[model samples]
Target chain A: MTASRKPVPKPTPDTQPFWDGTAAGELRVQRCAACSRHCFYPRPSCPACGSGELEWITASGRATLYSYVINHRPAPGFEDDGPYAIAVVELEEGVRMMTNIVGVEITPENLELDMPLQVVFEKRGDMHLPLFEPTGAGL
Target chain B: MKDAVVIAGAAESDELGKLPHLSTLQLQLGSARNAMADAGLTKDDIDGVACVGSPIQIAHSLGITPAWLDGTGVGGSSFLFHVRHATAAIRAGLCHTVLITHGESGRSRVGAARMAMGPDSVLGQFELPYGVLGPTTTFTIPALRYMKETGLTHEQLAEVAVAQRRWANLNPRAAMRDLITVDDVFASRMVAYPFHLLECCLVTDGGGALIVTSEDRARALGTAKPLVHVLGTGESADAPIISQMEDFTSSKGFRLSSAAAFAEAGISHDDVDHVMIYDAFAHVPIYGLEDMGFLKRGEAGAFIAEGHTSPGGRLPLNTNGGGLSYTHTGMYGMFAIQEAVRQLRGEAAAQVPGAEISVVLGNGGMFASAATLVLAGHRG
Candidate 1:
């Protein structure tokens, strides 16, 4: 039964800001002060330059479908949601993150490489999980 | 050659596919005894111990007092890394004979500790929230990316499974030796988009062990088993998570490890007589072939579809049926190495005629780590 429970994010001081931003309807990321590069899965220091002076910045909320698959075999917690799109989107800020693609049909024909996407937030308990939707899906 | 380190002995546990009577520790000990018996050595001869699963338990249970120990648990490929490190340890005089073992009850799950992708782990924090739990889900991203970039089709992926089954048909020890067709692969249930059930590795309970020692010692011992020399070895630890890979279409760790091994071996792709690319899934070999420099970009899927690597082809890949048709005890690396040694020794059931050199490449974690080894029948 423990495996059936949905997983939630546990935030540390280094990653708290990104979670807070998600709750506030913004996509937050880190930029290295020394190297002028961006990173995701927020950390205390820069991965590229190893500098401890990383500053938080709001992302453009823009991304593109790097790649994805419609998982027919759902995990225990996601038993009702079969054949859903598990996607990795490359953001405009030069980093990629794994997320689910929603607000459209989850099929190979509907999902294409380099398709534009936008960020959306879904609340799971106290955590606001970030998901993506196709750009301009509806009028 | 820098220093000659050969596989003095190698073996599988008492039985594979399913062993309800044994725990993972028992499997390791069983394999250790078999390998030591095959090598004509005793516990006193083993001065080093290395394993991906419970090195301490193996040493204690087997009554081995090793002066050197390596417990590198990278993934399936950890054994290849063990070989790499054992080679160095032998040359450095840190140990005389090294024993590397692998044991996993992937099917029976007996005495196997429950592994939860906890909320505190990095993957659990970033990707688990999205309902990604196993390799079947996480690996889908890269498989899709490869398909898009190479214009590969679903049928092409099925061809990989079909060809591997052809090789499996010749292997009696193979778990699913019944011949499969591309149609059969397509007909199988889909776990993820483009990945059919047949395309995935067999979940089985088994284990294997290997003994590495200086060439002088091996020759001195004079075991009847063929001497498979370790001509080259390489390992690379890349990102810890799948989402952090340098690119979705290729594995940087595979490239780095293969390149290092090839450079150390001082051989070209043409010199390889046999290969075992870890086929935990169909796409894995496609990545392994291209990333290991055996094929160019966007060519493995088609090359495989054309049967270039199957039996009677110019190159024989996964002669043991690979993890696809062969037994995959969670970590499939040791099995690949065992096959390469068999091919090099001219002792394999699905043997490649006059095989001189065999290249074994293994991927660990979720495309996060890799280790490669080039084995030769004789010192090259």
Candidate 2:
């Protein structure tokens, strides 16, 4: 049986490079040259310094679990997956993004706050989606 | 505009909760008409309108051409922002009278527009792809972090719902009126980890509107309806993304907005008699009390668990049961204001006795924006 389709990220012109980097197995985020700080969920100008002079940098792909929820009801495309972890992880560079935590059991005992996690890409539809896995992530 | 602007009229839709018969526009118009009637005025008196929906459409249907209009759809708190903006406009001679309305077919989705954005939108790109559905998952993200940092027990979080339910039991209009215990909260379905079904808010269909006009105009009406003054108002926005909120334990928007309003009104925590903090989830009021400076950081959970905010508590809060037991349309700020107006008018089903000063704190997006209103029954 064919698997139920899930949501896939459609990259815009501004975010096409980030998607391209993900497909090539590198996590990318924008760093502002003006303020020397990083930004995520790519946009035109820097959020901190309002500088359009931003450059894409390959991130370390290392993040710590900042916060998350175990969603009981899955999104439309995620019918196959049971209750899953929807996480907000703070990157080593100090920007945060919403992604799913995979590669471990979805239990309170298994997922701990501030636990170390590393990014991994999972292909869905025609795009690669970034997800996280626990490095030593247990309470 | 302290004591210069007053809510001359305030009301909810003719009937709230599961009104498949009423479309969103119908709900909005019905409430607006009721508010004008309560004010002893008509559409001809309204020269300004504000709402999350199309103000032009509402103005045209109401048969009044507004001199000023605002379609600020920041979030639930957008109505609070409207009151603030209307106060400024009246003081600036932009408009003398304003009507602010809210209606959401949240449960039935009657005439409610479905919003869809392409992959380029911030949320579509960062949040949607991760199998996140809606507020149940997104707004629930910060609780774990808050608990971790402040050591707020899961029971304290559950107690927020229980306390609100106590108020709901007193109000005839509240949707969920059955008295519930913290264990009942724990036993209710787990919509998300660290959040039980009871800890979440009720999803009901409703609408509310307010009529704001100059104090002179309100007095000239000669109607005995008590005037609820717009003493001080403040609006502010913070994180666009929930994950980006500066702090997990408190809302920056709430802090700034309420602080500004209180400073403008020249009052301290001792002066407030009632409060209606928008409670989309149980944890929100816990965040609201602390962030608004009613209590120190990390003190709200215990304060609530101690019965300080329940019926007859020292500081009564959410007397209309709040969004938890009260009606929660998709955007809940309008109802919060409506309750404050009711308490000020001595008309609330669960009225706080001698509630002269009512503070309504509104939350917009997923902790992204906030607007605060300090309302007084009489000039201080």
Candidate 3:
């Protein structure tokens, strides 16, 4: 594990594929073979139907900004990322995830609700963390 | 609608503020002893022991080898669930008397253990790596979205801190009791966007405990204080991680738990005279008020800003100053329940006149779980 400001995730048997997909610059989610609903944070069984027949599917890498905050206080591993926008994005696949909003200045004026966003990957030793940036500046 | 279970006694570990000398276990033992004494019972009489942390350790240290033990760790709301479980356990003859305890050295870090999210856990892998810190960082996401959607202003959020301080001023036990204004709240340092320093809960070291028993057993003891009956209780859980919350603008856990509790209690909003909503942050109460049906959606911010939740308001909420101004030792549900008991007993520092019914709500882990209890002064 490289010494990063944030803690690195150690992939488990159930979540390895999700992490592997991120490293390959693709957002991966589990789809219940029975329910056909997408699930983020990969699990062995489908959350909606509780079926063991699960399949990994690539996400569109597009999302809508649901909610966010500009954290003024620095998190231990994210001291440099302080005053950054921590956001919850609703993926096009209907799943939501937490990520940082980058490629724009961290300010209230720059961040807007329901804004279009696209996923971008950053390399952190042995892992590629997914983050989001506005599709077009303030669009 | 007779209450089957009653709260025999309730007490906190020590003073509200910092106490560097006491360890977490010491705090637990102190409050447990105080609760037992308040209930007019000895350790030998407690057949059940339940807590959020280390029931066996608390039981051993207190020399109580309970026939029933529950160490359900669901966050601050764990204690409320403990009471709910204790109620059923007592009625079913699983135990005669149940004692629940909570203690945390949040400020002093005395006897505090470092908790690590398992690297393989969803939180450790997906959320933690993104620098989504503790509740303070995670909670801001929903609060910001709530403001955008609900049109709640920063001043309105500030009003939550101002109103709670008014209640705290009347209580000597409150941690920050010097009257604060909406302006003061805005002037205070910002922890996260839309959250002023004062808008957040005070990090104090403290613990609270509750003693519960069957209605018959409570009557038999005949303590001077009126028995606080457990009329109804509820518990629910959502995704543990903040990012995966079912809804960003509202809490499904809060809605489900309070609804179940109110339904079981068979009471409408009018019957509630007093309330205690866990205020780990200023936004929490707003969420509680709206989701619990005391007010409609997007109405709590204005309701609180208009002084509805204050002392002179129609509904007396967080009479103990809440986690925002009172003591918050990480998990704040126990203290909320303590205040509800006080109101029902008519012994609270800022007592609500003729307060016969009290509703106490507790939230755990960034809206991950919620528990509500409808307590009454009498059997009905």
Candidate 4:
């Protein structure tokens, strides 16, 4: 059977910068200067203090696996990626990002709270999406 | 401000469960007609139609061409928000009667390709890349966080599932009336950590409708005995993405909306005789109760365990099985309102006795938005 192609996300103007940074092998997030709070999924204004003064800054791309779940059933395009670990990674900058955990098979026995991970870009049709692989796995 | 009332009627399509016979459209039309008949009116009386997911198309299918149409699709709470909007429109003399409806074959074989684009479709670009995915997983994170913070064990959450199931058994129209226990809840497959299959809501093919009209018009028609007054309504939005919330343990939108609603109703939490909280998932009511000021932070688990929310308790919640056991036709807030009205009218099959003041809380969009309505029984 032919493997279904993976699904590609289309970025909008509000989120283009974040996707662009990922393609360049850099993690970017909006930090509000007024409230000094880091935000993700870029918006027009700061959610914390409702400040329009925000700027994109490069992140360290280091995060800890806050929580995750293993999806055994894959979607149409994600058949080969079955049993993948979908995790919520809390970046060192205090911003949490949702991404897949790669480089290791996911099992309840293997998964631990606060596992350190680093971002790795996966190129998909002119877009390099940011995904995290466990550090020291030599990905 | 305006004396807006649920004057006309309400009805559910089929009893909750697997409905292979009807499509979403069929369910919508069936419930819409029932509501009109119950109101002693016809489709021509519906000048405004508000709904979620393809309201215009559904209206056209139902042969309804409204002068004012609001297709504000805010998930489960869409119906309550529609009530608030419809109330304003009716007060402004825009439309005489408005029909708010919802239906979904949640268990249907319709693939994601045919699914309508949601407000969060943009999040798929960045958030879905990491697999945040559907409402179940997204809601699970906060539920887990709530568990961690409140010392609520997995069993306490199960109590909600067990209680709602018990209520469903009394409800003839409930989808899943199988007697469930805390063990059943915990042993059920884990859709996400801290959320078992039993703890989640049913995916049934059903539809519900509510007819909103002016107080004067309602007294004129005089079909029903007791008039259920729409005391107040409030709505607020949170972060569209669950990850962006300031705290997962609490929802500010719920808190704000409830405060506004309570203030407008000229009542406090203590005055509420019954509450019909949307229970899409077990934790939703936990968070909702806390946000609605029924319990202190981290106290919902203990409050629920104490049987405060069960039948004959201090607060009779989800008296009609709730979305957890009753029909969860995608958006469930309308059903909550229907139950509230039934309780106030003393016509509920499992009616909370002497329920004069009832509060209905509607949650939509993964704890993203909330709408609260306070309904009081008419005192002659």
**What's the ranking of the predictions by DockQ, best on top?**
2, 1, 3, 4
Residue-pair clash count for candidate 4: 2
Task: Assign candidate 3 its CAPRI class.
Answer: medium
Q: Which ten residues in a row have the lowest lDDT in candidate 1 chain B?
A: B113-122
A74-117 per-residue lDDT for model 4 (tens digits)? 54556666566666788988988777787777775566657788
Off by over 4 Å in 2: A1-4, A136-139, B1-3
lDDT string for model 1 (B39-110, tens) is 889988899999985677888888899889999989889999999999999999999999998888889999
**For model 2 chain B, the run of ten residues with the poorest summed lDDT:** B115-124
For model 3, the chain A TM-score is 0.91
lDDT of 4 by residue, B217-270 (tens): 877766554667778889998877676666778998899889988988889787
Query: Considering every candidate listed, which one attains the maximal lDDT?
Result: 2
Model 3 regions more than 4 Å off? A1-3, A137-139, B1-3
- Write the residue-wise lDDT of candidate 3 on B1-380 in tens digits: 44389999899986757989998888888999989888888898788999977899988999987999999888889999999999888877899889999888888989976766777788888777777668888866798888988999989989999999999999999988999888898899988887889989989898989999987887787654679999989999988888888877789999999999999999999999999998999999999999899998899999998988898899889988999998999989999999999889989999999999999988989899999999999866
Interface RMSD of 4: 3.3
C-alpha lDDT of candidate 4 relative to the true structure: 0.78
The most accurate candidate by DockQ is 2
Estimate, for each residue in A29-114, the C-alpha lDDT of model 1 and write its tens digit: 99999999999877888999899999999999899999877888887677777688888899999999999998898888899889
Q: Using lDDT as the measure, name the better of candidate 3 and candidate 4.
A: 3
Q: What lDDT tens digits, residue by residue, belong to model 2 across residues B1-380?
A: 24388899998998988999989999899999989998889899999999997999999999989999999999899999999999999988999899999889989999998866566687888888887777888888999999999989999999999999999999999999999999999999999898889988888888999999988988887644799988888888888878778888889999999999999988899999999999999999989999899998888999999999999899899988989998999899999999999999899999899899999999998998899999999976
- For the candidates in turn, chain A alone yields TM-scores of 0.92, 0.92, 0.91, 0.92
